[model samples]
Target chain A: AQSVTQLDSQVPVFEEAPVELRCNYSSSVSVYLFWYVQYPNQGLQLLLKYLSGSTLVKGINGFEAEFNKSQTSFHLRKPSVHISDTAEYFCAVSEEDYKLSFGAGTTVTVRA
Target chain B: DAGVTQSPTHLIKTRGQHVTLRCSPISGHKSVSWYQQVLGQGPQFIFQYYEKEERGRGNFPDRFSARQFPNYSSELNVNALLLGDSALYLCASSLNRGNYGYTFGSGTRLTVV
Candidate 1:
């Protein structure tokens, strides 16, 4: 079984400022990592994923995440944030079974 | 190109009442999974069905059950609901077991009074 841990529960940032959401997971075997963004009362939208090959994976928007194998982390980062970037972010992990385990979620609030 | 669809976007039920949630997967997708998200929390896995068979289950109670139809649609039934059951029920669909960042539905908001 794999598990994800998102350190920050809430993050507030100014518009156009850079921000990073930290995530760590515990898995003994190979795992797949993903970041999803959810607006209020909406479904989750994929931000990016790390299956293999590239440690630095880019997704929609200006968001990106780096999968650190040794540290077992997949932290999401954005060079610049917009008001639209404010949303709840979740980091998930899955083993070979493809069953996803999600973190508690971090709420990002961007102010103008 | 319809994404996963879940019916009854909002529902209200009293404790001990039974509720059923429905979901329709994306076209050509054959796997469906159910998750429960409490307020201020991440989504918790409940059940996964593939090809009309049960594939995986989480730490939910026996009162929670689900079934998948031949068309890949699925239903989640919860018996003798509790107030703690009040949460957003999410449905996700994928083409297969491998990771494809399964498409998710808007989810059904179930409020158990």
Candidate 2:
């Protein structure tokens, strides 16, 4: 079985400041990792995924995440954030089958 | 193209009652999956269907059942609903079952009294 853990439940940052959301996972086999963002009252949108190849994955909206196998971590980062970036972010893992194990989620609040 | 779509954005039901949630996958997508997200928690997978057949099932009770239609749409039926069953039910669709990313719907919020 696979499981994900997001280190923080909430993170607040001033607009234009860099932010990072931490995530870790436990799995016995190779896994595919993903980051998703959910706006208020909206569905989850895929931010990026780490399937293979590079460890650092860039995603839409100027966001990126690095997959660290040894550390069992995949943390999301943005050089700068906008007030509109306030939302909830989730990290998920999928292995072999299509089922996904998700993190508890971290809420990002960007204040002006 | 239209994203994954779910019906009955909100619903209220009583304990021991049954409720059915509907979902329409994106055109050309063959895999449909269901997830349950309770307040302040991440989504938990419930079921996955491909080509109108069961592909995978999560850790859920037998009371939770689902089916896919010929058109790639799906329905999740919950029998004997409990208060704990009250949550946001999400529907996600993918192109295939190869560990690809999924497109999710807005989800149906089911409240059990």
Candidate 3:
């Protein structure tokens, strides 16, 4: 079984400020990592994914995550954020592609 | 080019009642999975179906059952629903049983009173 740990429960940042969301995982076998953003009353939208490639993977909305194999961490970062970036974010890990274990989630509030 | 679509965006039911949620996977998608998201929590895996067969199931009890159709659509049926069953039910679709990432639906909000 695989599990995810999102270290921060909530992150607050001002508009145009940089932010980072930390995530860690533990699994007996290799796994896939993903970041998803959920707006109010909406489904989760994929922010980025790390399958097998360069350690640093980039996704939509100017978000990028580095997959650190040694630390077993995949931290998401954005150099500058906008007010629209305020939402709940989730970090998920999967041993099998069909089953996913998600973290409790982190609420990112981007203020003006 | 529609994404995964779920029916009855919102539903209200009473305890001990049975509820069935529906989902239509993306065109050409062969796998559909169900998840439950309680308030203020992340979504939990419930079940997954591929090619009209059960491929994976979560820790949920037998009271929670699901099936897929030939068209790749799926239905999740919860019997004797409890108050805890009141949550957002999400449906996701993938191209196959492989490592392809999943595309999720908007989800059905099931509220049990």
Candidate 4:
């Protein structure tokens, strides 16, 4: 079985400031990690995913995440944020292949 | 592409009633998965179907069921609805039942009153 833990429930940052959302997971086998962002009343949008080969994965909207196997972590980061970046972020893990276990999402509120 | 599409964006049902949610996967995608997202929480997996067959299931009660069609569209049916079942139900489609990116639909928000 696999489970994900998001360190923070909510993170607030001013526009143009960098931000990081922490995520950790526990699994007995290899895992695939993903970061998804959900706008209010909207579906999830894939921010980035770490399948294999690369530990540092870059995604759309200038988002990136690094998978640390030793630390059992995959933290999402952005150099700078915009007001439109305010959304709920989710971290998920797939242990065998398909079934995904998600964390309690982190709500990112970008202020002006 | 049309991305994943789920029907009846919102629904209201009474306790002990049943509800059926619909989803149309992206064209050419053969895998569909169901997830339930409660308020202030992330989505939890319920079921995964691939090639019209059950591939995986999450830690959900037998009251939760799903099926995939030849066209790869799917439906999620929940019986004996409870107030705890009130949440956003999400449908996701992938090319295969693998560790790949999945396109999700604007979930159906179910309210059990």
Candidate 5:
């Protein structure tokens, strides 16, 4: 089984400022990592995923995340955040099975 | 193209009542999964169905059950609801075993009073 741990529960950032949301995972076997964003009263939207290949993965909305094997981390980063970037972000992991285990969400509040 | 669609955006039920939530997977998708998100928490996996068969299950109790239809639509039934059961029920669909990623639907907000 695989599980995700998001370090921060709330992140406040000024508009146009850079932001990073940290995430870590624990799994005995190989795993797949994912980041999802949820707006108010909306479903989760896939930001990016790390299945294989490169450690740095770029996603929609100018967001990106890097998969660190030794650290067992997949942290999300954005060079510049917009007001629209304010939302709830989740980190998830899946092992060989189909089910995904998610971490407690991190709420991002981008202020002007 | 429609993404995963869940029925009854919001519903309220009394304690001890049973509630059923519905979901329609995307076109050509063969797998459907259910999740529950309590306030201020991330979504927790409940169940997964593939090709009309149970594929995976989470740590939920037997009171929480689900089934998938031939059309790849699915229903989640919760028996003897409690205040703790009040949550946002999310439905997600994947082409297969979600090797890539799953498409999620706007969840059904279930309020138990």
Candidate 6:
């Protein structure tokens, strides 16, 4: 079974500032990593995923994440954040079964 | 195209009662999964179904059950509900078992009193 751990539960940042959300995982075998965003009272939307090849993966909304194999980490980063970036972000992992194991999630609050 | 859709955006139930939630996967999606999210927490996996068969189940109790239909739609049923069962129930769909990212529904908010 694979598991994910998100370091922070909440992060507050000023608009236009850079932000990074930390995530780590433990897996017994090769796995797929994913990031999802959820707006208040809304469904989760895929932000990005790291399947294979390309440790640096770019996502929608100008967000990106780097897959560190040795560190077992996939931290999300954005050069500049906007108020619209405020949402709950989840880090997840899945093995060949594709049964996703999710982290507790980190809430990003971008304030003007 | 429409994303995954869940029915009954909100529901209130009494303890020991039974409740059912519904979900319709995106067109051409053959895999459906269910998840439960508690307040201030990330979603937890509950079940995964593909081709009307059970593929996986989470750590939830036997009281929690689900099934998929021929059309790939699914229903989640919880029996003898407890207060702890109150949470947002999410449905997700993927084209195949190996699909990477899933399309999720807005979720049904179930409150057990």
Error (Å) of candidate 4 at residue A112 is 0.8
Kindly give the stretch of ten consecutive residues in candidate 3 chain B with the minimal lDDT sum. B94-103
Lowest lDDT 10-residue stretch of candidate 2 chain B: B94-103
TM-score of chain A of 1: 0.98
Q: Taking the tens digit of each residue's C-alpha lDDT, what string does model 6 give over B1-113?
A: 98899999999999999999999999999999999999998899999999999999999999999999999999999999999999999999999974578989999999999
Task: Give model 6 RMSD, 1 decimal.
Answer: 0.7
Q: Once model 3 is optimally superposed onto the true structure by TM-score, how far is the C-alpha of residue A18 displaced, in angstroms?
A: 0.5
The per-model DockQ list reads 0.83, 0.84, 0.70, 0.85, 0.88, 0.83
DockQ-derived CAPRI band for the predicted complex in model 2: high
Q: Which candidate gets the maximum DockQ versus the true structure?
A: 5
lDDT of 4 by residue, B30-60 (tens): 9999999999999999999999999988889
In candidate 6, which residue ranges exceed 4 Å CA deviation?
none
Tell me the deviation in Å of residue B38 in model 5: 0.3
Candidate 2's DockQ = 0.84
lDDT tens readout by residue for model 2, A6-98: 999999999999999999999999999999999988889999999999999999999999999999999999999999999999999999986
Misplaced by over 4 Å in model 1 are none
| Model 2, span B24-109: residue lDDT tens | 99999999999999989999999999999999999999999999999999999999999999999999999997377999999999
User: Which of the two, 1 or 3, has more DockQ?
Assistant: 1
The pairs that clash in candidate 1 are none
Instruction: Pull out the clashing pairs in model 6.
Output: none
Per model, the share of native interface contacts recovered reads 0.78, 0.87, 0.62, 0.89, 0.80, 0.84
Residue B85, model 4: lDDT of 97
Higher-TM-score candidate of 4 and 5:
5
lDDT by residue (A1-112, candidate 6, tens digit) is 7889999999999999999999999998998999999999998999999999999999999999999999999999999999999999999999988988899999999999
Candidate 5: CAPRI quality band: high
Model 3 alpha-carbon miss at residue B42, Å: 0.6
Tell me the TM-score for chain B of model 1.
0.98
